[model samples]
Target: MTTMAATRRMGRQSWRIFSMQARRCSVAHDHTSSSDPKLTNFGYREVPENEKSKLVGNVFTNVARSYDLMNDLMSMGLHRLWKDRLVSKLHPFPGMQHLDVAGGTGDVAFRVLHAIHKAEHRAVGKLGGKSEAKNETRVHVCDINPNMLEVGKQRAHKLGLENVEDLVWMEGDAEALSLEDNSMDGYTIAFGIRNVTHIDRALKEAHRVLRRGGRFLCLELSHVSIPGFQQVYDAYSFAVIPAMGELVSGDRASYQYLVESIRKFPSQEKFAAMIADAGFQEVQYENLVGGVVAIHSGLKL
Candidate 1:
């Protein structure tokens, strides 16, 4: 046989081997050895779909007390500004019925509630008299982790809002919200959807719970694609975040998983497409911190 022919044959064999290995890895990563379809990602590893939530719950339970502190240290307190930007995009108003899922710490919920009150007060003052009807606004804070919810409740008490009639806390799963159809005027989830086992199901649930013309907004850590900045951002994420998590929360493994989870999540465009597929319209997103985080928005219209 000619040397060139032998080279061609060798190339074909190498390609076949590569393809076979890639397929095997893909199947194993998405399913068990028995080819079970009920497997999902837990960070970089694959696990039973039913177990992901419990694993995630334990992680949060371990760090619930220091979650906020870790956020401050890791992001240099920019999380607050990112959340405030989310609320401003929400355009909250009086009499709004908002559901803040995966927001057990009440960060987003508190901002929505405060925005509603400020808007209500401004309208009341403009009318030159107090309205007879009280503001019927409600902000429901929901999370899958009870420990995180307890942290939010304590914060509310510290702020003297424990007795506030408009605030409600519920422990609920994002993929299967207990809310009625057409129930909420707005839905927001900050840094939460990435932790869900089925992000598409959670998006559909967000659409289901929202009334017509309602909006869905999500704030999450996302991929970076800038020229030189991407490398710097990645280095910080992999090295500094876990260290900060250990120093502040004493849970290095959980923070390491969190960083890997962000990498495993879909890109901003792909996630926006998923939201649109979930029956949301007018889908859009804004990248913050050069794509360290992204805020995706959609309307139920």
Candidate 2:
């Protein structure tokens, strides 16, 4: 085909796929709203509250192998810096107990451990003595999807952290964490809350599990409201991201839902309010990349 003709054909194909997904999303929303009061969004589509988790699980499972690569591609490797900022805000300390929820790729958890290790070393350097015992320090990585947990475990093994007792991996739901109250010094979740069926419940659970003065931090994709930039961002999100997903991971539908879910998520201001309502004090948020992402934090007191 001629270059112009091929370009036109590809554009047509992309639009067709986008339209089909939109129709399905609309139908799902209509059906659920009319028939079931207990429904939550799976991207733009509505599904039973209980079923959203399984649907989200399927998406992660399908893209698990390519998750990190796709993140690099979609964000142009900025995700690494974003995660670093999240951990830095966490201010990990030696002999601290931390929980990283929905961090199935071990990204945030690894950073937390690295920060704690550095803190321990710094203490030793300051005192001119051996590092204090960190046997009580632990970083727990919790996620509901077993496949994602397995991926985290495999990555931990490859990084030689499999034998580290301070790093623990568990399969558990964020809304109902299987942890005792006042058990954690810090909590974090990255790029994962948009898929949650009940974000409020998860926030409450974070509060419930944290000790007084513990911090909760969340990094997530959010809305972009800059006038000219919003248009460009929307075009990129609706067009380029799904195309990249199709070419790289052979799963355009999942990426479509992923971006759509970002839109469905609460705004930074509203979410910060939700955290406060969940009994957190000093709730605040910082927007990054013109609000393409945000980090929300709160302290339990």
Candidate 3:
């Protein structure tokens, strides 16, 4: 699949809020830049609004090779469990069309495909639905980073899914999807929504692309709620995670940015509200690991 980027000029109000968040994140990260009338946040640092996506792309590029490794190390292998939970919630089946946006690593797509295979295998014996089992299922793995897309393709190949015609790698922007409206049965963005420059716009695109009764699910790092555990989590996020990134990926700044971006994201309730504002129904979120990660789900009703 071809990759397409979404770039648009920011409105006055949105730009103003983004600018202030950039400055606040800068102060927190201790990376000060000159005051500019036009700016956006690049992991706690303010840069030209137009340059933010490029800077973010560079960060992901630098760590693309080590992204999964760092995820395991930083989360102590919990990322996999979190992702598995997300896939379980998706409940993919034969003939389903899923769009795994921002899942450049193909984890979500892989799990869903495997689940479909498992489900079809079981139903084939009892129902003799061999033809149904052979349906052309598709999972479009879309991301903004080409490097990440390459990694995901390599992973799919490694998994012996090279013969599968269903997995398609696409480089796309979440804010403005290249896909047709109401074309997909399900939309998933795991650990990807927080990276979007405009989370609400991304949600709107998700709404647009999903057919009626389709599901929209997003898994992301969120604020920790446990009283004492919050402090412990913060220390680990600020200190240990970045150090691990430096040692493993040789890029502490990128991991530092990761931590700060999580900090800057809206809380569970607030984010759910944004999803509702984007015109979803029955918007709700499940807090995982004491809200260190959250899974928000809605239906395009």
User: In order, how many clashes per candidate?
Assistant: 0, 0, 0
TM-score of 3: 0.86
Residue-by-residue lDDT tens digits, candidate 3, 1-301: 1110100010000111445445444432332243443565666666776686887898899999999998876776777888999989888878788999999989888998898888778778778658474667888999999999999989988999977888888889998899999999899999888777766678899999999999999999877766556666766677677898999999989888888888777667777877897899999899887788889999998
Superposed Cα deviation of residue 126, candidate 2 (Å):
1.2
* Model 2: CA > 4 A from native: 1-36
- Candidate 1 whole-model C-alpha lDDT, 0 to 1: 0.83
Clashing pairs in 1: none
In candidate 1, position 56 carries an lDDT of 97
Residue 151 error, candidate 2, Å: 1.4
Q: Show the colliding residue pairs in model 3.
A: none
Candidate 1, residues 133-184, lDDT tens digits: the string is: 4457889999999999999999999999999999999999998999899999
